[model samples]
Target chain A: MRGAVLHAPGDVRIEQLPDPAIVEPTDAIVRLSATCVCGSDLWPYRGINEVTEPTPIGHEYCGVVEEVGPGVSSVRPGQFVIGSFIASDNTCPHCRAGYQSACAHKVGMTGAQAELLRVPHADGTLVATPDDPDPELLPSLLTLSDVMGTGWFAAVAAGVRPGMTVAVVGDGAVGLLGVLSARRMGAERIIAMSRHEPRQKLATEFGATDVVPERGDDAVARIHDLTDGVGADAVLECVGTGEAMTQAIRSTRAGGGVGFVGVPHGVSIPGGRLFATMVRLHGGPAPVRRFLPDLIDATLRGEIDPGRVFDLDLPLDEVAEGYRAMDERRAIKAYLRP
Target chain B: MRGAVLHAPGDVRIEQLPDPAIVEPTDAIVRLSATCVCGSDLWPYRGINEVTEPTPIGHEYCGVVEEVGPGVSSVRPGQFVIGSFIASDNTCPHCRAGYQSACAHKVGMTGAQAELLRVPHADGTLVATPDDPDPELLPSLLTLSDVMGTGWFAAVAAGVRPGMTVAVVGDGAVGLLGVLSARRMGAERIIAMSRHEPRQKLATEFGATDVVPERGDDAVARIHDLTDGVGADAVLECVGTGEAMTQAIRSTRAGGGVGFVGVPHGVSIPGGRLFATMVRLHGGPAPVRRFLPDLIDATLRGEIDPGRVFDLDLPLDEVAEGYRAMDERRAIKAYLRP
Candidate 1:
């Protein structure tokens, strides 16, 4: 099997690797139909996150099940399936409460940017489509593995409701999808904060009712100004920086909510500020598995086109270019054919 | 008129002061029916919070309206009323959204431990009872001014619901009432974290199903053990300390909520822990005004007895002893009569 591997900062290579086999009784081998480079992947590739050793990369994926262990009863071979980046048993108390990302028996996925990927807890983690989806729906379905689901979680966590004015920070794929999610949830006014022209256009197309091309305190001021000084009813923090979190908190009205989905790099919230602001804070790594079934159905029905976030598409062998394009900000996201 | 003044740390005196008069057209002067020393008062009394100068003390009171400015329309002279420690114009967007403490026009009340107290935004700040209550209902109605309402806010912010396991941190007056609030909210199993025997007994009387006499990590461990390693479904953080906040966060199950009403002094939450724990956080100064009407009605109906927290009753001239008793933890709370 061929897979992408991160050797060092800014160095990614496509190399032939041993094919993955069912390592656990609950494991399944998925032959990738599509996979994508995630913004989080840049952490190690940029050396911001230490690269202790060469490692297989990528976690977002959707594909046909090639084989399944006897213990896996929920999904069968040859079925098209989508699963969360993090595998969860789906039976623990946390999973039962719809926080599968924090499931008692959970596993973070890696080495998924490959032709064949091994997924543990297959019965609990993988959600099969009604049938094998069309090729056009592949990209959108692939996103259910992480990005789109994360965006949906952000909106849900922020308590975005009908007639709500929602603000989304960060213009990454997740943020753009958040604009879409808020729209789907019936938010009356959706504000997208982005400095880049192309991303701003995408945000508008994804149902952003307004756009503020500002950052930090400036962005907060813009939101307040836009909301008649009441701030937004809900704000999604898609970038995990302290600045982004602070801006998100400040941009929300008192009693509103801030759903933060970004993996924090260096964020610490002062208790006094949070208390004074009186905003609800809820977020974390998204429980993508919880949304896979509905999102997959929505994609198949053409209710949303989250796949448009994939501005760059590449063949499996060009995996190195996929990482480079995203790293250079030349691509919003890069989808790969395996 | 006479009022309590904090001259310095450990120095509270009952001194003669000018009787409060309407300074704002929206103000109302009330002759206090009752006042109480609060757990927060110890912050300055014990010198944990600096006493810059002789400041008029106390912010919780229930009283009879003695005079109303021309602009005041809600409560007339001779009416019995309860108002929050923080006054707010109930019509502001924040107040309309039920966060009166963060209202557009908010005023923190002081000199409330006096014979006559002036309240701002009277029409919006004060809730008049249906009629003058029996003397037995005065204390409970008085608690609706701050402590009871704050505890109710903590239970609400934590999203306590039927059959959920709830935990209360801090055995103070506010935490004790939180147990009662949770009970009223239909939480099936209420755990009160308190080491003091008296508080534990009071907690049991207030509907606490269990009592864990532990602090910090030990308390969190006890909660986990009580919930069969799942942690509490909701936690009320009534203590405004970093350790208490951390313990509350740790004691909640993933996807649970921590409603913190503590006035945080030196507390900071690490983004990493918050993200990984996956618990929702909501808090602030209690929007007591939002709950005042209902709480007042409940007190009048004889459904709740929040005033039981006041273990010591002192005359107005003994304000020094009222402060000293609470400061020394010799009394859970002290009620004052003019």
Candidate 2:
């Protein structure tokens, strides 16, 4: 099977790799119908996060269960499914509390940017759809595996409520989906911070009531200006940079919450300022497993079209091109057909 | 009037000062029934926090309203009242949201260590009691002004729910009160981290089921051992030091919550570690004004005795001794009677 591998910074290759097979009784072998590049992949590709060795890339997928091990029961062969980035045994205390990403027996599923993948904790991690989703819904379903779930977590963490105004920082795929998630959660208004025209347009389509084409202090000021200096009731920090984190904190009202889903790099939360601002902070890895069922239903019902984030789609052989397109921001996101 | 003035580091003097007058129409003059030295006060006294000027200290008090300006209506002369350290105009958006400490028009109500103190935004800041309380309840009632309210906020912010295990980092007045607050909020087990025998005893009395006399990594390890390696469900960080903050985060289970109410001096939250821990974090100066009415009711009903934190008592002229005792940890807290 062909899989994408990062041999070095900016060096992504589509090369022959061993097809994944179930290694545990609870595991399942999935034939990926759709997979995609992630913003987080850029962390190592751009040489920001250290990549020690040639690493298997991608952690999101919409796939079909080709085979299930003896212990697999919730899902079986030929069923369409979406799973969390962090594979979790959902029966644990943390998983039961809707924090499956921190499940007691959790494992991060990687190498999904391939034709076949082995998923551990299949019964607890993978949620089967009522039927095979139509191809038109592939991108959206694929997002349920990570990006969309993360966006939903961001919204939930930010406490975006009905009749509340929310602000989203970052114009990446997660940020765009965050706007959709906020709207779905009944947020009255959403102000998306985006400097790119295409992302701003997508943000608007995703239900952003306003778009502030600014960064750092300027972005914060625009949010304040938009909200009568009170800032948004909930601010989603979808970018992991220090500037974005600080802006997100500043763009929230005194009692507002910040749901930061971005993989932080060099961010440092200044305790004094945070205390003075009195903004509530909650975030971390998205407990994607918890939101998978609802998000899947929403997608199946056509209530949201998160797949719009994937502007470029390519064959698995051109996975490097997909990574480059996303790296240059030419595509909001890239979808790879396996 | 006499007030405690900090002429320099380690020098707290009770000096004769001009009596306070209503500087604004919303101001009220209060004859303090009780004022106390706070753990935060020791910050400047120990020269940890810069005191550039001869600052009139003390920001916690419960007193009788002696005179009110024409604009004051919610509170009147001869009424017994309790207010927050931060005086807020309750009409502000933040105040309306129950985050009065972040009110747009807010002022720190200092100089309460003096015989009489002038309070601004009296209508919004002060919550009048039904009647004068018996002297036995004075200590607990005084705590409502800051420490008790802050502790309550910590428990609440930490999302302390029924049947949850809560760990409190810090053994000061606020930390002791946090154990009480967590118990009242239905936390099944409370762990107070303190090495001081007196503080540990008080912690037990205040509902701490376990007293972990460990600090830093030791504390984190002990908490893990207690919770079967899962850590506490909620952690209340009442100490402002970086070590305490780190320990609080480490002592909480993944996807747990950390409510930190310490007035941070030189603390910086390392985003990477926090992100990895996946702990929900919320904190700030307690919106005491929001909790005042309920707390006052509870105190009036003799439900809690947070005033047990005040282990030393001195006349208003001995305010210096009060500061000294707290600075030296000879007292958990000091009460100054004017």
Best-matching candidate per DockQ: 1
lDDT of 2 by residue, B77-191 (tens): 9999888999999997888888999899999878889889999999998988888889888888889899999999999999999999999999999999999999999989999
lDDT of 1 by residue, B19-56 (tens): 98899999999999999888888899899999998999
TM-score of predicted structure 2: 0.98
* Residue A258, candidate 2: C-alpha displacement in angstroms: 0.6
- The number of residue pairs in model 1 that clash at the backbone is 0
Interface RMSD of structure candidate 1 (Å): 0.6
**Second chain TM-score, each model:** 0.99, 0.98
**DockQ each:** 0.90, 0.79
What is the C-alpha lDDT profile of model 2 across A211-274, one tens digit per residue?
9998888888888898888989999999888988999999999879999999999889989988
- Please give the range of 10 consecutive residues that has the lowest summed lDDT in model 2 chain A: A91-100
Task: Extract clashing residue pairs from model 1.
Answer: none
Off by over 4 Å in 2: none
Candidate 1, residue B226: the lDDT equals 95
Q: Every prediction's TM-score for the first chain?
A: 0.99, 0.99
